[model samples]
Target chain A: MRWLNTRTITPLLFMAPVLVFAIVFFFLPVGFSLYISFHKWDSLSPPEFYGFTNYVYLLSKDPQFYRTLVNTFVFAGGTIAIGIPLALVVAYSFSQSRFQTVWRSIYWLPMITNIVAVAFIWKFVLNDAYGMLNRGLALVGLPGPGWLTNPSLSMFSVIMVFVWMQLGHNMLLVSAGLQSIDDTYYEAARIDGAHSGNIFWDITLPLLKPTILFLLITNFITGISYFALMMVLTEGGPAGSTNVTSLYMYNMAFSDLRLGRASAAAYILFALIFIVTLIQLRLFRRGGVEAHN
Target chain B: MADAGGIVRSRTLGSRALTVLKYTLLTIGAIVMVAPFLDMFFGALRTVPERLARPPVYFPQTPQWDNFAQVFREMPMLQWGINSLITTLSVTVLQVTSSAMAGYALAKFEFFGRMTAFRFVLGAQMFPFFLFIIPMFFILRYFPLVGGNDIFGKGGMGLLNSYLAIILPFAVSWHGVFLMRQFMMAVPSELLDAARMDGAGEFRIFFTIVLPLVTPGLATLAIFVFVYQWNEVIWTMTVTRTAPNLQTVPVGIYLLRGAYVEEAKMSVQQAAIFLSILPVMIAFLFLQRFYVRGLTAGGVKG
Candidate 1:
């Protein structure tokens, strides 16, 4: 009877792959990474138990560590400062516009394209000499600043390209939120003699608060952790002006083979991200019902 | 907000100007979105002299369409393409199969530990790719009895430098499973019960009935996985470092960046980039509907 039932066995059989994958890939590797963080490991030799040294050095002793963290925040902050509002406006525009399929196709080109190709395109576009941007600037008799070469502007260039690349995806998210607001609400607002500007401010903007806040947290997290663009675009160049924590950790682990220190850095970044998510969640939970009012 | 939800409006003068302004902004935004790509396309067609000229060429004087052909001769484009195809296809098929199977199990079956498995999936998504990069490399390197490793997973390369390393970590997509579960939940239970009563095996019922019903979800998940895996750089680059033979197109282009970074080779580089983007672009052109659905659905979810 038990064999004929096939109740438990069939489900277990079907679920085997994902369960195994989760254990092996997700849980096991994370545990191993934590264990490796406490011990100095180069993979070429037996790991030496280093205890708190790796964590301490990253937290206190490393200047590049602190600098990279700041650069990361600047990159993340810059992205939200520039990207979120731009995406919101563009998305709002997209909702009002016709020929949506055509518009969406054009906008989402970068979203579908690889990061390598994106970096290469922008590298050509932003070149100081003989580049499209500088050449355009030259025709108008305006000064063309070094977008990538200048240490101060390197992070800016990185941020702009990221924003440019991500605009379509973020727009897709915001547009989803915009479309969620019912037509009756707009009709009701219009019937109350609300002008377009005031209706936008009072009704639409308020409804979009949750979506915008969600975007802010997600985009910030993405900006902080993402360094692939920097790797292919600038390689954290011009005196490490654009260096970020994950990129630094990447090189430390793979390039320099300082696996232990890198693991400690990864843990730190993870904790910081965790803390950020918690703070945002707590703040948003308090302000959750305020959007309705 | 006046335009919210397709409201009817009288043609007031201020609203007319507003419409014009909105159109202008939309046109400008469209141009901005498309210009970089057009620039790249034109860049790919330029002659060597045009590229090197002072102030450089905005448009190609003579479109060297063969520059696309030149991409293959310049690098292992064919090899990279094949590698890319192999890895991406494997990951896609594996992820879809695994996710669908697991999703069906969790959604349809009343197993004892179903909630626990479901919770594990929900929680596992929080683990970002960065946290796994280093440890995963080591894990694959030390995987017991793989790629000539000992039982203790020592004294050999394990799964490193092979397609397995590139494919195994991504064999199960948590989000895919979650999405598939959501789709599977929509199927009525009575139909499944009827099938069971009719002496149909569970496997047969799942394959014949459930899968056909969830084609839209499968299509959504497939396109997402394919494009993502096709363009995946970081993990692929990390594992395929010593094994350049296994490098995908993006990784191949990236690692050998020096060869194509110069102004003279810029056309070929741009051509190669365009070629790399073309396959997925065309596929997306046809399947944009599913992608839009997935994007909107994913956005609505946490």
Candidate 2:
């Protein structure tokens, strides 16, 4: 009867699909990507071994590669700096308010909506001539710059959209973090003569650090992966001001058919994300372990 | 006594001011979030001429209720909607199952190389989707199978542009597996131990106890996959083209207009765009409770 017990094999039975999927879909494709990176492969032509030429050229000679990297960082930084704080504030407000549920939903509305739909509406609203922003500016007697066309403002506009789209989800996460804090702490703080400012600064921020750190890291990863809006809104135009590394990788691979170069570029982007995630984990590990230790 | 009285009065005044200030700030934040959706709805309502009016109409003179009908007529929108539904649903089910199974294995099993496998999977999740799109595209186009194909994987595009193209490659999610594993690990071992004492099969124990307890985590993974697959445009666009047939809603709506709203029949494009996203928004609204629960659950541990 003990030998007949079926408990041990359940995990194997259930995990078979995932195990098969990872091997066939994930690891296989990843290996092919790496193998293709060392070869000059177009879509039609057979891949030719080029060794490390693609990597060397991309790293040492390509100005566009570096520009895209900078653009990716700039876009990610802008979105994080503004989006995280704004989300935190709004989430905190809603947490304190009686209408927390309603406010959280309202903020989350944008996050769930189709990005293409949002991008189209913005495209209509940001048109230099007949745009909503311009018309509003005209009413207010201020000059409206070309939001999506002007190179200087295009990336900025892209970042604004990114920030808007991301704020809601981050807010929800932060609010949950806020709610998780024991109510007794707030009571103790009040008894200690803490004002609103002191309560927020001392209690809320420290306790919500885990959520904040999670939000920041995820935001950074997703922010740098901002290709959907770029594809719909600017198409990385106005002299490529909005071209992030991801978008650049996509175009190089699909549009230019430079499979090897794109693979190298993709590897670079992956490396960048890896380093960033590592740094983040290192920074947050101390805080996390200390709290639990 | 006078000084204490002044301080009390000042506190009351300060609190009132703070209340007023808080309301004002919230209103501003709400406006920022709400205004864009309002504009999208209004854009859908306005006519082509009205949409391109010199000053840009914020409010439509007459609502183009028929625009939605026009959207149905203009493209295989019905088909696109179906495609999105089929793909998203299939992917969600597949992901939930795979992730759950893998998660269960990781939580309960003490297999060799288990930790290494977990770490490797975790590392793989950091690779952006764009990085894998091209290689994935090639593999899908050339996978060996049923039809007459040489061992070289070339005899009429293997899986490219088919439903299988989208589904098989993304059936399992590393993040989903990781998340579910965390959730499964948190469940008490006492339950499993009790089941073992009863001579219950592992499968039965998992099905009876662990599965029910981890509904919240499974629900989170479902919503995540649903939203991610629904909103995903980059890979979908790269793989699919020629609208009115193969396109998803996101890609379909993208093709509705050429350059201007007037070119595409103003009301039709607007309506098509609206309809394209209607299912997702409706789904979101209906499952708002689940979404919040899932998001909160995921975030707490994330």
lDDT of 2 by residue, B2-39 (tens): 69688667767876787777667677888888877676
Each candidate's DockQ: 0.54, 0.55
Q: Which CAPRI tier for candidate 1?
A: medium
User: Which stretches in model 2 have alpha-carbon errors above 4 Å?
Assistant: A1-8, A289-293, B1-9, B146-148, B186-188, B196-200, B242-244, B259-264, B298-302
Model 2 residue B155 CA deviation (Å) reads 1.8
What lDDT does the true structure give each of the candidates?
0.88, 0.79
Candidate 1: regions farther than 4 A off: A1-5, A287-293, B1-11
lDDT of 2 at A268: 79
Model 2: share of real contacts kept: 0.59
Error of 2 at B43 (Å): 1.6
Interface root mean square deviation of every model, in Å? 3.7, 3.0
Candidates' chain A TM-scores: 0.95, 0.94
Query: Which pairs clash in model 1?
Result: none
Model 1: native contacts recovered, as a fraction: 0.62
> Which lDDT tens digits does candidate 1 get at residues B1-302?
56733454543555787777777877787787778888899999999999888767678878999999999999899999999999999999999999899989989999889999898787677666889999999999999997889999997999999999999999998888988888889888899999999999989999999999999998998998999999999999999988999999999998888786577998998999998899899989999989987776645432
The structural similarity of chain B in model 1 to the true chain B, as TM-score, is 0.94
